[model samples]
Target: MYTRILVPVDHSDTSAAALAEAIRLANEQHAIVRLVHVIDLAQFAWSANEFLDVPQLQSSLRESGEKLLTERVQQVQEGGISVESELLEIWGGQIARTLVDDAVKWKAHLLVMGTHGYGGLTHMLLGSVAEGVMRHTHIPVLLVKATESK
Candidate 1:
């Protein structure tokens, strides 16, 4: 019986599936759902390198992240579910670390995420956020493998 469910969305199709699952679980348990979107500062840093002021670029990134979160929050709220949203602009580090930190901070009972199937070399080269979260967090995690879109 989860009272607080955390759903991390990156606007990907896989994430959308995860969000839907989270909503279903929340609805059944009458739980509160928290939607979190972490803006990878590392990605923004690359953009900053091309510009003059890094700080200014960071600010712009934060604003964009906030806007994206706000729109998603609105959509979730419109579904008639009790929801809270967060847009975290964390400095480049580890996505898994950031996600687990937020889950603990919010006291989330469950974590629902979508897994973008990555193979050996690909998985090794591009770290899997879900894998990191699962390894570090004690909370229960339900991973939904990405479904093909028709």
Candidate 2:
């Protein structure tokens, strides 16, 4: 009986698939969908050091994040589903925590996300965001894995 669904989309194929699934489920139950995109500030911060100036770099990154979210929101709205979208530009270090916090704040009954699998050294080096969200959030999570590139 999920009435409020939170779909965290990153414009990835897996996320798109999850959004489609969420749309179907929402339509069946007449539920509200909240689309969220988290802009990892930490990643931006790190990249800022490589740029000419921190302020300029951060500004560019923020603008890009906003544009990306807006486009995705428009796409979702076109599907004839009632939707609310949020763009959370949080410091990169606390992405997992911030996502859980937002989910609770939104009072989401379920969270749908896409997972890009990491293996070997990569997996160990960059931990799993989906796993972190699953471990921390009280709401149920539906993870859709990306299809292998042919």
Cα lDDT computed for each candidate against the true fold: 0.85, 0.80
- Write candidate 1's Cα lDDT for 1-150 as tens digits: 898999888868888888888878877888888988887666655754766677776677778777767876776677678998888767777889999999999999999999998989999999799999999999999998878868
Which is the leading candidate under lDDT?
1
Residue 143 local lDDT, model 1: 94
Worst 10 residues of 1 by lDDT: 43-52
| Deviation of model 2 at 23, angstroms | 1.7
Clashes in each model (backbone N, CA, C under 3 Å)? 0, 2
Give candidate 2's whole-model lDDT: 0.80
> What tens-digit string does per-residue lDDT give for candidate 2 at 33-92?
998877765665565386557677767777876787787777767777789888887775
Candidate 2 — number of clashing residue pairs? 2
Write down the RMSD of all candidates, one decimal each.
2.0, 2.1
Q: Tell how far residue 73 is off in model 2, in angstroms.
A: 1.3
